[model samples]
Target: MSTCRTGTGPLTAAELEDWYAVPLGRADGTWVRAGLVTSLDGRAAGPDGLSGSLNRGSAGDHAVFDHLRRWADVVVVGAGTVRDEGYGPLPAVPLVVVSRSGDVPARLRRAAESGTRDGPAVVVLDGHGEDVDPGRVLTEVASRGWRRVLLEGGPQLLGTWLEADAVDELCATVRPVLVGGDGPLLVPRSTSLRAPVGSTTHLLAWEGDVLVRTRLR
Candidate 1:
């Protein structure tokens, strides 16, 4: 990824990977990191109401998205986002779909049922009639030894995690565009956490996309 930070040249691929890696000594608890793409006006989706649309032509954002996925030991996403984004199975990386109804995307359902080895096992984590608890999800993730967690979200899912204080880091890519109509924000308006949650750790730019890393604790 190219960095536009002053006094620095483009970052090498290894350097970029290091920037996204889990801290060296973080073995005690799960490190939950969220990845989201937003527009210049703070809208999480484009006019199309899908996050992928926000990064439509931005290679940098796409690169960072892939990097985050590769860095994750397990990927957690809400069922709605998975459906809205037309998500498929990832090769060798477990995908945990959190759903209130215990429903998952069709492709994942097929993959899970077929006992397919071509992709990572698709797991449906039901909330058992309650709001899917972020803590519960993380506990299960830790149980599986997948501590380097990545949360790809729909806004409601992200807001819930933020309210529960289950998120450790947030990796946001701000595209240089605007979608002025009503669109989702980074978090839900009803989220109880009134204050901003984290400290800015890194601000790097690549191909007009600004990547921000915020440490939540």
Candidate 2:
């Protein structure tokens, strides 16, 4: 995968890594980062109701996505995203999925059962309703020494975290394509919500796609 380039010039792979490197955890404290890709019109997913379609021609988005995963100690995702994306176990980093039913996906379970080299292990954090407590989820991963948290969300999960002001950073990829649909936005709609204020940390582009990293203090 190629590194992201600014409008002025291209960046090397190491430079890109430095821009997206995981921040060090302090004394069991976690740095929560949410990674999301959306279309030009702010649709989190395309017409198919999946984020993958929105990533069709965004190689730079994919590059950042992979880098975020690799740099994280563990990947935290909602159960619906796991099912919708047909997620398989990761090769290295452990995956912590939030599922209400406490049921592990068959594919993930199969990898665990066979003890294959398919990916790292999966831990299902059972929640009560449509989502789980963001703090609880973070605590679970932090307990396991996985403090560099990467949230690959499906709206509700991300929204909850954003509402709670638990997200420390946000890495958003905006593709040039416009997806007009009832798809969810980066943050769930809330009229009375106090959105977190963030500072732009890095902005990079590649193949007409834009990657923005924001730091929320």
Largest TM-score belongs to which candidate? Answer: 1
lDDT score of residue 88 within candidate 1: 83
Top of the candidates by lDDT:
1
Q: Pull out the clashing pairs in model 1.
A: none
Looking at candidate 2, what is the lDDT of residue 100?
A: 68
Q: Candidate 1's residue-wise lDDT over 1-217, tens digit each? A: 2222221214566877877766643557567889999988989999989987788887767777788878888999998898889888878689988888867876787776777745667777777666799888878887878888889998889989998988888899888898988889988788898676677767877777788888875
Residue 156 Cα positional deviation in candidate 1, in Å, after optimal superposition: 1.0
Cα deviation of 213, candidate 2, in Å: 0.4
Model 1 segments more than 4 A misplaced: 1-10, 24-29
Of candidate 2, the 10-residue stretch with the lowest lDDT total is 1-10
- Our tally of clashes for model 1 stands at 0
